[model samples]
Target: MESSLSFSLPETLVLPLKTQLISSGSVPRSPSKLPFHHNVSLTVSLTVGTPPQNVSMVIDTGSELSWLHCNKTATYPSAFDPTRSTSYGPIPCSSPTCTNRTQDFTIPASCDSNDFCHATLSYADASSSEGNLASDTFNMGSFDSLDMVFGCMHSVFSSNTDEDSKNTGLMGMNRGSLSFVSQMGFPKFSYCISGTDFSGLLLLGESNFTWMLPLNYTPLIQISTPLPYFDRVAYTVQLEGIKVSDKLLPIPKSVFEPDHTGAGQTMVDSGTQFTFLLGPAYTALRTEFLNQTTGVLRVLEDSNFVFQGAMDLCYRVPITQRVLPRLPTVSLVFRGAEMTVSYERVLYRVPGEERGNDSVHCLSFGNSDLLGVEAYVIGHHHQQNVWMEFDLENSRIGLAQVRCDLAGKRFGVAH
Candidate 1:
């Protein structure tokens, strides 16, 4: 557990946070230096005009307005151009969403102030966007009976070579925001994602996991500085079990190391989309894996497993390291209780074409390269059917496992 000072959520902090962390720059903070309450999940991606084009993005419920990358000099191109995205056309002071609109948000009526309710988005490469809010359509599989609106930042700023320019725009799915699901007041919704092969769901509002698995929630913190995406939740990371070559290793509280000396600040973040392990904890685990399965170990590059924004410095070992054969069950000890995870859950799967031995593929896990930005990122892939309760006032996070059938209905375990 780590500790971090709480900051009040303000409206003006959005620009700086986007400029520094979300866009291009990486914010350097130890994984243990964050408030347990700062977590949110959103659906984001980009698309072209009329017949929408396919663009990747990070969905954010924390934001109300939705926008995609655009361009100014673009002619009759095949698809959306990050180099020429939506540009913010100057709206007169009489505009509804900006001035005459309700003052519920931080956007002020005065256009002179930077906080004026104007839609201007910027990227780290110096590209910027200026646009307005517009209703956008959304459809996930057959669950398409919903309608919502998003922002069209007429002036989108992004470089052709910059990685951020790759996506169209973000979808907002925050608890208090206006999304298709939120507007329709859908009592239940789920976001499903698969890597190169497998898939999982991000269930919102309710799930079967709540009753099946025991869960615990951490505390919440207030954001003093205002940012466009300010909604957050608390998380408690517990180690259920650790094993190496059929040997169990006990992790003590002393293994925990936080940079700021803050207390009880460990958090699980979906926005980050990476899993980060502390230095001491990682070192111990790595040493154990190597020491036990020194035989039949293949020294392959960790880069083999790719799940978008996953970290690096990961490797794979054979199921022979453990006693189980079907799927190597790796047990984790979280909050004093032991939780066993099969290889399919955490390990990267290598297709038969890529397999070198008797196993289907290697285990997929988090990369270690995402050190300063996030310590432990429980990405969208591994957290499927897991109902996560983000309680701001209570300062805790609760997880409930769920089972779904081919019909996507609630059921027992997968097997």
Candidate 2:
């Protein structure tokens, strides 16, 4: 029987930069009880093991293997203690799941001296989790508990300390065999992220969401042949062109095509915080954006003004100005549909004390080339207030603009 479930994502603030921006009133906030914070990531709560120990996990569509910090380390106090769970069963190295089913992972599964299936999962930010593959009962607010496979990470290495400690683990929502959505046998799942509070609703299985707004769909691209650096399991989509203020850029369509190595494809990733584009696409966008904002806003030409070595197109705003000048809209034209990004989503107000008297706002889009990945990624910031549905059965992605806060209230998902 097919089972459907709903999860309410509560906002948890992470990343010092975003925290400062929210505190400084640079980012908008709501006065309601469910106030929205510009959180770096969205997290959902779930119970694990026999006694049902609660765990908070980040929702990451870009990744496949779900994992949890295990065996109380000095750093992680809320880590899952597998020994305490009566139903905890570690898969042996001889199991097919450890050998053949780990293809979705960047690193192959290995056998430890204890004869258990060991796996190492790596991320784009150079962080990694080394752990053993194990099965446990997951109670995700469903009528019945599910026996699911996940990683019990013993050691985690992360470059960003502030971002890593926010969540107990990550719940991978990708299309891989071991992902939460795939393991649950869900044909379709939908999520609506509130632009105001960053709180959202995640619905698993076929659910009607068109009552909010009409959804426009685009076919999901599949990579038949795999390459070393290319991610074959991502939610890949065909990007045809880009339009700044409804005017299409002069870039050719070939620039968006994947090379023989399968590198230049575009992916819709919730794990990434900011949108990133290939060299050609990013350059054209930056040039046109600067050309449009020349007279309206003061440009910040300082070489040190770059954020994360990707966002360099910055503008200075007086601290006294409560309202920002009108900015152009950016539209990402996909094969069958286009996503129009509003002016607020296009610019990120820089947070720090270094900007003497004026506030700095930079283009939220970044150059993907800096990450050495020749591809485009649409991040969560661009997905705000959007109802995104991943229809696995039809192999397509559906998108619609919605007031997610209201959606959450209507669905009784708001906390």
Candidate 3:
């Protein structure tokens, strides 16, 4: 049977530029629905456990296991109290779900002293979460209540700032066995992100795009074996080339392919806020972009103008200019498809960096070399106002351009 669900996202919740840059860090079946919000990260509010304890979770496609702050702490004051829920059941260490199905996690699962399934999840940024695997009844929007597996996190650690304090945990929507989408057996899911507003729409299960804009498809890449610094379970794709306006950059196609170590593969990750490319491709694109805008925009050459030590192409915009001058467009050429980005989406206005009537704007694309990864990532900032569909069954991704605000209304989920 074909199942589907629709939900809305709250208005844009703008955050500090530093927090937004640092936090640069979900699915159903049977027609269940839930709404989400656009904070620095995409978040969804849902009730878990018996009698329902509401918690906000960040939606991360790059991750697998879902987790929540289980106990109150000096940092997480509003954590979920498992003692108050009767339906909360921790998985046993002997269970196959804990021992056999944790290969997708960054760290292997282990047995705690009490024989409970101990889970340790790690991220690329060195942040980590440790807890026990547990199940509880989850309710969201029109979705029916069902017992879902998630991490009852007892501890969280991060090397960066405490930017995630406002969020309870994270919802993983990747292709791993423990992810929400994989656990629910959802065949397909879609989301439309708005560029102008925070209001967006997320749909799960079988989606009907007949009434929406036409879509272009690209095959999803699959890696059979695991490699260090590369996520095999991510939504990987082949990036053929790149075009600055109508001119394709002079970059070798081999620069986009993964090396023997499985690096350089491109992934569409909603968890990251900005796009990143490998060193070679990034350098070529950056040089071409600068050449095209040589006279149009004033370049910032100060050594301290870098953003998060990733984005370096900074520009100075006068406050008197209400509208930016016509800038070149960028197109990401993919296997059998391409996505063209407008000038506005290509440059990001640095928040909290405005000095009097002058403001600092930087190119949204960053170099992945700083992260010590040889992979390309298409982040949420580049996906604004686009309809992105992940078809797990067919192993393909669909892309289309549409006004997300209107698309939300059309789905009858306008917030």
Best of the candidates, lDDT = 3
lDDT of 2: 0.79
Q: Show model 3 residue runs off by greater than 4 Å.
A: 2-33, 159-162
lDDT of 1 by residue, 1-415 (tens): 1112132211110000111113111233221111011112233322333333454344543333445544433421222443342332334445564554323333433443434345554421244556545443443322331234445555554543333443455544444334433454434333333332222333433433443445544333434343343223223354434664366766666554232333223344454333445545555665665554445345456455443333332345454554323434454445533334444565544433233443333334443443333233344444544545543224344554444222122321121
lDDT of each: 0.39, 0.79, 0.80
Q: Once model 2 is optimally superposed onto the true structure by TM-score, how far is the C-alpha of residue 366 displaced, in angstroms?
A: 0.2
Better model by TM-score: candidate 1 vs candidate 2: 2
Error of 2 at 145 (Å): 1.3
Worst-scoring 10-residue span by lDDT in model 3: 13-22
Instruction: Give the alpha carbon lDDT tens digit for every residue of 55-105 in model 2.
Output: 767779999999999967666665888988999999999999988889878
Give the 10-residue window scoring lowest on summed lDDT in candidate 2: 12-21
The candidate maximizing TM-score is: 3
Off by over 4 Å in 2: 1-38
TM-score of each: 0.50, 0.90, 0.91
